[model samples]
Target: MPEQTPERTGQPVPEPTSNQVPRLVVTWLVVTVPLAYGLFQTIKSVVPLFTG
Candidate 1:
């Protein structure tokens, strides 16, 4: 077997490659967009409490 590199030594790994870029982006957007929207809506709803 090939020797383990620094990535396998409990360190931060390298960045993904071109083939993985789109998938990573889609995954992040799918997960983050709704979460960010929810957070925004929560903040929007709570703003009135502080202002009024």
Candidate 2:
């Protein structure tokens, strides 16, 4: 068991369950998919400008 500090109460931190794992994956994909697409499009546009 973990110890509690003065600022925090004696309550132990709750561990994530099995269902939360997929939620984390979905959350990351939601954030990362658009980020990856934007990066790809930006690089593609920049490459043409540099070459031409």
Candidate 3:
């Protein structure tokens, strides 16, 4: 076996700073909101067909 570096072994992961958290949260919310809305609309549309 060869010696391992941080990149090779994927150890010692870099931690995100406080500023990064909000950006990530905002990004996730922006993407997920649209996806969730689309899913909700699809389910609503399908449910009417099944019920009728």
Candidate 4:
């Protein structure tokens, strides 16, 4: 396990660094893109049920 710093022990978590931005973006896209595609497919399939 990692050692804790005295300052960090009692403090709130620090803000994400600039280096983390790409990782954050990629993570969000990885989750959201598949979610969006699933929603689109569901809607597309359900529309025919209603229309017919």
Score each candidate by Cα lDDT.
Answer: 0.90, 0.87, 0.90, 0.89
Which lDDT tens digits does candidate 2 get at residues 1-52? 7556543895676765988999999999999999999999999989978899
TM-scores of all models?
0.63, 0.62, 0.61, 0.60
Query: What TM-score does prediction 2 earn?
Result: 0.62
Model 1, span 1-52: residue lDDT tens: 7678866777877765887989989999999999999999999999999999
Model 1 error, position 48 (Å): 1.5
Across 1-52, the per-residue lDDT of candidate 4 in tens digits comes to 7679656588776666997999999999999999999999999999988899
Model 3, residue 8: distance off in Å is 25
Model 3 clash count equals: 0
Per-model root-mean-square deviation over C-alphas = 7.1, 6.3, 7.6, 6.7
Point out the worst 10-residue segment of candidate 4 by lDDT. Answer: 5-14
Report the candidate with higher TM-score, 3 versus 4: 3
Distance from true location, Cα of 13 in model 1, Å = 18
| Model 4: residue 30 alpha-carbon error in angstroms | 0.7
In angstroms, the error of model 4 at 41 is 0.6
lDDT of 2: 0.87
Backbone clashes for every candidate come to 0, 0, 0, 0
Candidate 3 residue 14 C-alpha distance from true site, Å? 7.2
| Model 3 C-alpha RMSD to native | 7.6
